[model samples]
Target: MKLSFYLHKNGAKYAMLTSIGGCISILGYLIYILNPLQLILDKLLTFQPGSLIFKLWTQPPYEVLAKIYIFNVTNSEQFLAGKEKLNLTQTGPYVYQEIVHNSEAIFNENGTLTYKPIRELKFRPELSVEDPDKARIIGPNIPLLGISSYMKNEYGLFMNLGFSSVVNMVKSPSLTNLSVTEYLFGYEDPLVELASTYVPSWIDFTKFGILDRLMSIDNGNTITMHLSTNTTSKDDILYQYSVDIFNGSPGLKQWGYREDIPEENSPCNTVEGAFESGVFPRHLKENTTVRLYRKAFCRSTSMIYENTDYTSSGMKYYNYRIDQNFLSTSEENPENKCFCKNSKKCLPKGFGSLDPCYYGIPIAMSQPHYLNADPEIRKQVIGMNPDQEKHDTVMKLSPELGIPIYARLRMQINLNVSPDQIVTSSKPFQGMILPLFWVELGIYDMPSYLGILINIAAQIPTIEMVTSYILGMIGALMIATVGVCVIRGFNQNRSDVESENQGLESSPFLSIPVQPIIRSEFKLLR
Candidate 1:
């Protein structure tokens, strides 16, 4: 009875332990199937539009650095000898300040999201040079009034000038005097009206096309956007943009493809997928190239105007091509009016041209000081010393989370100058793409919770296995203990029964009272 009671008590505990262990094992398997990216996406959607989380995840974290380049125009003779000389000015490291002019994130009726900015760029007064007098000039030092006028009027080189460069020779006011931040990125919102017309920069966002297409367009429909004049505001032109998206690729609803498609359909379209897959994720075979499209502010020119017509349009669509090796090459060009007609203009690895977008000036784009570009480009220019450590654009990311632990995007600006008989002032600068300035945008270290989340996600498998093993062991031990108790109880009961039987056989009630007394008693009875 004692053994039965003990077994009953332990048996209930064993059954409960078995059930708990089974539950834990099931949970362990589920942990293996956890999708961290999907979880992150779900959490991101919960934040308010203006919340810190929304801004951090949606907007770019660009810390601007203005690296001004100076050309050695003194050696006009060497440049005339088929050699180009350029140098970087030891100018103040101008840090840019930016504030969103309009921080409104509008949700459209079509289920798309749009954000507008008139001129979000501003110079932080506190971080900038305290003395306006001490602030360094941003553009070329040589007076180009005659040359600029000649290009503008005679060559029909009418185009807006980037704040970094002056279109006409008039000295621009001090950085403090210019109201640089008052303008809207787009004069009017593109999505406000569903019209298919082009919008200029003063009234519109110059680069909004990229953002719009990224979040608003349908898959089969090509993205179209107008180009903003970097400097000459004489004309407004729009161009067409294109990029192919395969089914199942990670893309927004704007792409109009089914979100439920299998990942094997090829290429990742979403922002997370792009970063994780290195911009183009598909059946990326060796040596194959992929084209990525984005809207950029390009300096416009008259030459491009003549070729493409007032379409000022080509600038709206500039693309960069990259191979599976992650190495990039320059886009193919029929002819770029902004580039030198005589030299090799093909963009090299790490170097892209804004020529298609801007014509009066030839702007070469690359990481700050030509980082990741062919060493020869830097070697030709005097002040262009590429530093692999600081200038290089590096992206170290978590493949699963599609978030970067460290990221840096650096772009250097260089202008090409060739002697043109049409403008005599350009005689000194012949066959040279002078380095003007470069900017850097960096992001490092994720939010604490995000970091913690990544860590927990990484350890989940181990946690599952360990917990399941421990519970399984406990359950097995409980069962073994129950078996041992049952066996011992059975043996004890058997021993007791055997002893009782032996005692019964010896009991006086079952035997004749006396074998010895039996003989005398039996004779008397007879």
Candidate 2:
């Protein structure tokens, strides 16, 4: 009705009407058109992340992707198809990176993912969460992907009273190192594949041709940062192969495909007669919510025009009004301003909710034992990648105070620079999460009750087993002594008056001591 009414009333603005109608068509079908029973069942059974479709939203693996690190390999031969043998001089910045971007109102077709040689690219960035003002991410790999680099440092400072680096401490060296099984390759099997008869009419792609239309419309789909590090620079300037984009992968490309179908479990791999086996619980529904996310990530370069990224680009720091917040137990807003680095910028949190603040430590393959690590341990082992100079220097000066997570991460980044970039973060940020006393009542109660029950239960076993068997050994030696004492007493014919029996002190078998009486206030309980 909305569409028809608008068409008739403002048909004069034919272009706007036509364009909005086109969008409505794509979104309407992506949502109301598809059904996947097998996909739903598999997700529920495995409790895979996708089961959280309402929450996790397609399980885009943003955390892992955010942490991907890149390395550059200098080559003289043609590395990518249709490329040339270009030698990099032994000098300054060299390596390059690639970050992929896509936009299509919904999950895009696979053409974009299938190997495309490097095209236009923004500079690969070398960023530091420890120092947001120092974000240096650009096209390929000149030095950084400051976003991940910063979080890595923040994780490190929160972990060790030790050194961190903007460059070397990067725990994982390649993008492949950061992997998530959010999607199956749309495999076909009879269990997950329903009879063509049961399939719903709305989702029959052959008739609707949504996929064909999606690809044809230019939603400005693109893959950002797909270049190698130009490591051969004037040796004096800088020489390292860090590609912020592809995170070390040279020419490898990624692919995406969607099947317009449904089943009991999942629509992918079949198992135990079910359509598919699993989907991660955290991942969102592909059909219902995937299109909604299209806007969040679609990168409306238009929005970029409206707002300047203070922390990302080179901007004067003091110009924008500074704000803070406390996510921990204190008064929950940023309070008290402190002087920061001379350069201007903001932390992701400071930039407000422009984006979700994502942090991670790359899982290193060199030491595969990291598979079962808890979050804290993982942060310790993974560390950041600012460079040796930065990590070691800041670690020498303890950053925690009166400190917050963002501050600790920032001061650590401050270590790797000319005196000019020295800065500190004033915002109240959190570090590795720990239980706050008042907030975690549940954690305390369960253990105390279990201990009480276990204590009472242990008494039965203790008396039944130890009173005899263990007592036999201890009683044997004591019996002999008692007998000798009795004989001695008889020889004496008289005994001295018995000493006073201390209540609990005299009773050995089951004496219960008086426990400390807590004050009335402290004794309060739920």
Candidate 3:
């Protein structure tokens, strides 16, 4: 009885231990399979109110520097006399800190948000090569040139003659020496005042500042973006927080695309699916192409993958550059034909017309020093030295988060001078695309705190993997312990049975005895 009781008690104990081990193993496996780490990460990366990413998007922590380099005309006399090609000398890198803020953000129910961007520029003298107010540049008369170019196309002969008379009365020089500050911010010119007075509809502002007009923010302009938080699908997550609309429209009316036009017909004017320079999508791949939209540019520009690289802190980044065919003529890149504004004649292979967006001013944009421009266009200028290192537009982005680690966005502003026989001052600049200035705007490096956050975000996958492995190991160990318990229980039960049988065989009273006189006893009974 005692032996039987001991065997039952030990068997029950083993069974209880096996149940506990099985439960622990199952718990460990469930933890690993559920992947709670990923859930936490997704929540952190989502762009919503009170989220880290949203805060960063609203106000970036790093500084964006604008370095302006103006091109000074050195041989204006000789060039005007038709004796020399337009000779230019590159001038100072007047630095400014550009502060951006997304104001009055409103979150919508359809997984989108809208906000107005307010940007301010502050001069950083310490970072500049020289004082802009004191630095002088002998450059083309922008007011005279821009007006002459506009009138040549829009005004009749009588209007052109009147404009020519006004120009002669004001004695506007074909080229003028002015402080860099005046050239960039604003300058007092009688021609500009007269134009504003006469044609307020076209030239409302009496002062014309290239950078000032470019950076001016319209209060009514707002940007709507996809939050990318509604779905957990990988593909959907790849395009997180991309632009959805600009100024309440996906395509610009200025670029000949109205609300009625299909997006496929006017792809160049489509602003949707592009990202602002401050933020990009997550999980960027090598083959992925990115488009950046800026109000100043009036269109989105494409950036293609160039190579893979590492930041100074050992974080991985993917390098991208402005598409080489971004400004190419239709002959070179047919897709850019829409930029010609329905005209069969497009600008030369290098220039992009900005007149549609720049108040009828015949301003064109190109890469700094006309890098990769047509040989003919470069031949027209004497001082153009297109160095890839200094002139090319480049952006280094984190592959995982699509964050811009370092970027240099370079662009040169040029005036398209179409000479008018009626306007004699413009005849000197006949058939010329004059480079006025170029700007390099970007951040040099990420702040240390931002780098730390990026590193942590990058390590999330590894952390999740390690955690899963640990949980799996724990589960395996618990399962193995359960197996050991089962084996030991079976062996103990068998040994107990054997010992009980031996006891029965060795017992005095409980044993069975064999009879020797069985045959004789059987016969007597019969």
Candidate 4:
């Protein structure tokens, strides 16, 4: 009885242990299936005000540099005299630090946030090749060239005659020598003042600075972005926080898209649902295409996956290059037909007209040194050397986090000069696409704190998965051990029962018959 009691007690103990083991196994599986860590990460990555990602996005704590190289005219006099082709020499990499942040933030109930972008540029002399104030470049007179080009397109013969007379009276040269700072920032020119005075409606500003106007912070433009609060799908997460609207509109009015035009019909003018280079979609694949919008570019540019790369710290990144056909004419790419604007024929396969956005100036944009441009466009100039390594626009993005680690955005600004027989001052620059300057805006290195966060974020999934797998294995072993113990206990109990049965059958007392034992006892009593 004691042995039976002991076995029963042990069986109850084993049953309790088996239940615990089963529970542990179930708990491990639940952990693996639920992936609570990833859910926490998603919450942290949301664009709420107090979230870590929102703080980083609001005020980026990294250095962004703008390296500018001006094409200085070497032989202005000889070129104007028709004695030689326009000779140009690449001058410098005038480095400037760009400070950017979002201001006047307004959170909306529709899962969107609106804010005005504030950008400021400060010159970094230590990083530049030379002082922009001292370096002089003989380049085309931007004001004169732009005004002349506009007049030729919009005005009649009588207006052109009057413009020519005024040009001759001011003795405006086709080219002027000015310091790099004046060319980039602002330069006092009599023609600019004259144009402002005469055509105040068209030429509202008396100053014309390429960089100053391009990087103007007080434009009163606000951007609205979608916040990812709805779904946890990988693609949806990647598409999170993309641009939704600009200046209260999703399509650019300057690009001639009607307000009612569907997004599918007008892809170029539609600025909605693009990344502003501050962030990208997560889990980028080889076939993933990214669209980036910049106020300076005046439109969204597409980037395609090129290859894989690694950061200095060995973090993996996907390399994306600007689409080769971004600036192609309609003949080459039918989708670009909208970029023609008011022109009957599109600008060559290389150039995209920026006149619509640049206050009616005939400014065109191309790859630096006319890379991937028509061969004839390069043949018209003397010193243009297109090198892909130095001029291509590329962005290196972290696949897991969808963040841009390193980026190089290169673009060349040129004057689309059309020779005017009516305006004699423009005769020297007839039919010339004059290269002005090129800029490479980039972020070379990430801040240490940001890097640490990225590292942690990148490893979280792997760590969580590994820990879950280990727990599952441990739980499986525990359940298996409990099963083995229960089987052994059952076998031992059966053996004990069989031994007891056998002993009862073999005992001398039990072997005697019950009736005979009773009869013997009665005779003894008598």
Could you estimate the TM-score for every candidate?
0.54, 0.15, 0.85, 0.87
Candidate 3 per-residue C-alpha lDDT over 167-271 given as tens digits, one digit per residue, 9 for 90 to 100: 999999898888888889888888889878988987778887778778863334788988764465556654567787888887777777777748445568787
lDDT of 4 by residue, 252-283 (tens): 77777777657544778777778873876566
Q: How far does residue 245 in candidate 3 sit from its true spot (Å)?
A: 2.6
lDDT of 3 at 374: 81
Residue range 1-526, candidate 2, lDDT tens digits:
4334544654555445445545544443443333233334334433122343212222211211111121222431242222632122111121122223322212224211111122121222462122212322211110122223333344444432221232233331211111011100012222112312354341222211111222222233232221122335432111111111221222111111112322222211111111000111121111211000111111111000112122232211111111112111112322201101111222222111112101111111111111222333234212222232221111010011000001101110010111111111101111211110000000111134323322333233333344344434444444454455445654443232232234545776655443543454467752
Candidate 3 yields a Cα-based lDDT of 0.80
Indicate whether candidate 2 or candidate 4 has the larger lDDT.
Answer: 4
After superposition, candidate 3 runs with Cα above 4 Å error: 1-28, 217-220, 229-240, 308-314, 342-344, 478-526
**All candidates in order of TM-score, best leading:** 4, 3, 1, 2
- In terms of TM-score, the best-performing candidate is 4
Instruction: Report lDDT (CA) for all predictions.
Output: 0.39, 0.22, 0.80, 0.82
Error of 2 at 12 (Å): 69
RMSD of 3: 5.1
